[model samples]
Each structure stands twice: as structure tokens, then as C-alpha cells.
Target: MKFALVDDIKTEAVKGAKGICPSCGSEMIARCGNFKINHWAHKGRRKCDPWWENETIWHRSWKNNYPIEWQEISLLDEKTGEKHIADIQANDGLVIEFQHSYINPEERFSREKFYKKMVWVVDGTRLKKDYPRFMKGKSDFITTNKPGIFKVDFPDECFPYAWLESSVPVVFDFGKLFESISGISNPMYCLFPKHENYYALIAEINRKTFIKTTLNGEWLSRTEEFLKQSKKTKLNRTFIQPIENTIRRKPSKYVLERGKWKKRRRF
Candidate 1:
């Protein structure tokens, strides 16, 4: 499977995950949705930590929970003939970078012009926050009155993206790490894939490992099998109405290989 390491995971991905800087131990961290993975940005004192700007809430958490060796990398900014430090680097060909700086013309075009197996976490602050700098027409989860409301304004040109509840952009390989949701440890994973401004109903799995089989449409029958082995199901849910609606709209598109509980609808 192809994996892309991002400097930040989408805020939506962290909606219930947790909120704290991975490095300097700060609470003023924010996450936005990027192509498929989420992007994180730090907003606080600049001098307290050197790695704060490069680390997001999830990144910090990942480091604490699982300390993996990362290498320092340098990449040339094509727009400006200068070199910048890559956010996080793996021994393999994985390079993670986060762009929290205010987006200027050069910065915007700089990302577009660069060609590497890189992940970009764009800002959706206008959609997620109440700052004076927020852009018009951006969605905000805080302002929206609806429950289970997560919105992120994504640029159409971006690839493999998901809109998080914080109205932050999250981009990733939709087919790869998405399965990770089903394996979450404590917090139940509830995923709602919102595309084209359409949202599916809430659906969840107790743990991340379950996502792989569930994604294959085995939730109903496999629910029992998963329950017997699940460590945390007290509050676990992930849903996508479009997929269900798709199957309902066209039953021929899906093949039910499990059992006769086909007519049972939980939502």
C-alpha cells in the first residue's frame, strides 16, 4: 500500500482523537483537512518550541505513543532558490511537511510547482475558526447549530481530500490509511465522508482494525464477530450515507456476501 506521511493529520481526524501539540505540549493547536490526510497548524508563542510549527496535535501524539525514528531532511523551495527543512522524514521515501504560514502568492504557487511524493495540509481556518482573518463563505463547526456537523471547504483541484468537522481540509490516499480509522484504540472512530457538499449519516466502528472488513461491507454480519473481540465499543461509530444511499439507489452495485440481515437498517 502507498502511504504518505503528513506533518499534520486533518482536524476532522482529530475531532474526537485528542487536541495537544505533539512536541512542545501546547493546547493552542489546530488541524485542517488536506487531500486525504489532515494538516495541523500551531498557534501560540513562537519561542517556546522550535518544532512546534512543524508538529501538529496528532503528530505529537503519535510520537508520544509510538516513538519512531525520523530523519531530518531538506528540500529546495522552487519559488525561492532557498532550502527549507522537511517536517518529518522516514528512512524510506516518505517526506512530511506542513505549511502553517500565511499563504501568499509565492507560497501558494510554491506547493503547486513542487513535484515529490509529498503531502500538503491546507488551511480552512475561514471555515473552522472565528478569527477576524477568516475568509467569507467558509463553514465553521462552532457556528453551525447542527450536531454531528463537520465541514471543510476543499479546493476542487486538490486530490484525495476529506472535510473535517473543524472545517479543516484533510487529504490522503482514500484507499490506504482510511482503514486506520477502524483501528482506533480509545476513541470510537466515526467517519462521515462528505464530498460535493453531501454527507452520509453517522456510522462508526469500535476500533480501527474493523474498518478494513467493514469497508468491504461486512458490518452487519460481522458485527457479532467484531463485538466478541472488540476492546472498546462503548462509543464507537463511523458512518457514510453516500455509500449506503448508493447501494440503495442501485442495489446492483453492491454484493451482499454476509447474511440475510440485509433489510435491517440501524440508522
Candidate 2:
């Protein structure tokens, strides 16, 4: 963990420092070794929370982007007496989890329920195969009326299987920090929760924009608006388009796949 309680104050890990776990109030000893980044370890390294994952440089970078006080917040559920440390619980009550390790679908669902209002910032570059799969799937993206929004026929092809059914928005960060030219060439992509069975909605998100909006508490509202607009788009295409406009038009470009003409739908 990045921060621990020393003298009842949040402090970063330092060699020879002994502190208390902010979440479980257990003894924490700072380990400043050559292998991993300096971090506080629980007594005997017995993890107090099963949900907690080992932190990496990427995780530390994301946590440091927000304010110090917001990083590694301890949250509790009064009803279940459940407690866990959140990576970042924004001032606006939005939890931003920076996930680098794999999480099973059941545990993923449990976290979503715990942090009802949350956003997942997944490390897409963790596995070499991840970004390549997304690039392959990107060629099939169906453009939407909204500039940065797209309709994905098969989201599983582009994103990690764990995130396809996320209750909250999951943003994949495929860029290697300091390696890109502009963010650099890799911008984050957000896969929205399931909307329609036929396709999934995705948005190209700018990293800076996401951080600013989240800090000012606009993230939730903006996400809700996007969800509503997607529903409207589906409704318009299904029922609101004029009958003449829906008629099949002369095909300028067509491809046959599995006995169906791709791109045959009226735009």
C-alpha cells in the first residue's frame, strides 16, 4: 500500500519505518528493497483483505494522479460489516480502481456492488496480447452519430473478457507511460456496460478529460448522459427513422459474410 497511518497521520513508506494499516489497523512495516517499489507490508505479510492486490509502478502512477488524501481510502459497509481499501475515492464519491492483475468475474461483480459509483482504469498493456486483440477488433467498429462513440458488434474481441459485463464503465489504458509520443498515440478506450444484445457502446476517452471531469464530479452525470443518448440512438434507428429512409439503398460498398451482407443496414 502507498500510505499508512504513522502517528495517526497518513505517510508514505520509508526504510525502517513502522506504521499502522489505515484499513485494518494492523502493524505495517516498510520494506525498501531493490526488487519492488518501497511499500508497507502487514505483519508477516499476511494480507488483511483478500481483495487487495500487490501494487506495481503503474498502479502507483495512477494513484498519485489524484490528491494524497483520496488515495487508498478505506470504505466500509455497515450492513455486511465488510471493509476494504479503495484505490481512489474521489471527493465526488466516485471510486476509481486501477487494476493491473486479473480478477475473476464473480469477484469483479462483487467489487462493482461494493462501489456502486465507480470507474475502472485497467492496465491494458499488462499482457502483450491485449492491445493486439483490440487493434484487430477496432477495424470492425461501427461508427455512431456521436463523434467519439462507436457501436461494437463483439466487445469481447476488443476488451478483456472480465470487463465485458461490468456494471460500471471500464476504461482500458493501452499506453506505456512515457513510451508514447502524445498520450502518445494510444488514447484510452471506455467500454460501457451492456446496452443492447446486438452491439455494445464504446467511447474514445481522453485521459486528461477523464481526470478533470472525475475531479469536478462530472463523471457520473456525463456517463449517465452518454447512456441515455445511446438508448435514444437505438430507439431512433429502430422506430423513429422515416420508412423511406429505412428502405435498402444502392450499395456502393458491400461484403458478404456468413450469408449476410455486411453494412447492408440503412444508415
Model 2 agreement with the true structure over 1-267: per-residue lDDT tens digits:
888899999999999999999998899999899999999999895897889999999999888789999999999999999988899998889999999999998999999999999999999888889888887666666655555667755566678767777888999898643332123244688888855546677788778888889889999999988787666657233322221223333332333344222444556
lDDT score for residue 73 of model 1: 44
lDDT of 1 at 30: 35
Query: What lDDT tens digits, residue by residue, belong to model 1 across residues 1-267?
Result: 011233453122252234444443344333444633353334555333332244444444333321244422445556775554445444433344444434444443354345244334333232323222222212221112223322322211121112232111122211222222224333222323222222221222333443233234444344334333332331222431211121112222112223111232435
Where does candidate 2 stray beyond 4 Å? Answer: 176-186, 235-267
Total clashing pairs in model 2: 0
Model 2 residue 97 CA deviation in Å: 0.6
lDDT of 1: 0.32
Decoy 2 TM-score against native:
0.84
Root-mean-square deviation of candidate 2: 7.9
How well does candidate 2 score on lDDT at residue 152? 59
Using lDDT as the measure, the top candidate is 2
